[model samples]
Target: SFSGPVTDHAASDDCGVAILGAEPDKFWHDHKGAKVNAIRTRTLISKADIIVVRFGEKYRQWNAAFDAGMASALNIPLIVMHLDEHQHALKEVDAAALATTRTPEQVVQILTYVIKGTLPV
Candidate 1:
């Protein structure tokens, strides 16, 4: 039931991807608790070459805020995809993304550019 911008990107295998918040704790409590999960999350971000910030229709403020902060603090490259066009006006959702996009394809393209060092990512 993957909808929105991730439909195509998830279907393709362009890069090694780490889908943040995709794992549901109710079904698979691998991390055990929030503290462990948070530490694991920081490790993941620190290890990643780039981070993708996908802001959907109903913005998950906590995830967005935390993930974005982690990426910034870790100096990981980031690409932000505002699935909808009006996310910039949200005001409350604050993220210092290197670049902004409206689709998964754009996010991928931006990633490519970042990897190539031709674009600010």
Candidate 2:
């Protein structure tokens, strides 16, 4: 999650914001650490209002499924950014609940709009 105050559109002021990312330590660490990190990341995602996931060949693991599940269970918006040339199977995600793209800047813009209440669903 984002670790600082962000501009909240609801109040039109700065509010504590959290940008929830999934299983970072798992993706970068060994098996022993991945399990623990997955749990921690899931916990964070369950508590967040928005979840941003980078989808590509690099994240072909099942962690992405876990993140998607968390977002679905919470009924929060899930933003998937495709950064690579490889096509991914997005069938597990709910089309109505997900926002997908191929750029980091698009993700940032969407997040900013979400925080500012300017995004059109």
Error of 1 at 55 (Å): 1.5
lDDT tens per residue, model 1, 26-45 = 43433333444455566677
- Per residue, candidate 2 scores C-alpha lDDT tens digits across 11-61 of 211111112322345343344344445556667776787887666465333
Score residue 30 of candidate 1 by CA lDDT: 35
* Model 1 global lDDT (CA atoms, 0 to 1): 0.57
Find the candidate with the highest TM-score and give its number: 2
lDDT of 2: 0.58
**Runs of candidate 1 exceeding 4 Å displacement:** 1-32, 84-86, 89-95, 116-121
Q: Residue 28 in candidate 2 has what lDDT?
A: 35
* C-alpha lDDT of residue 19 in model 1: 33
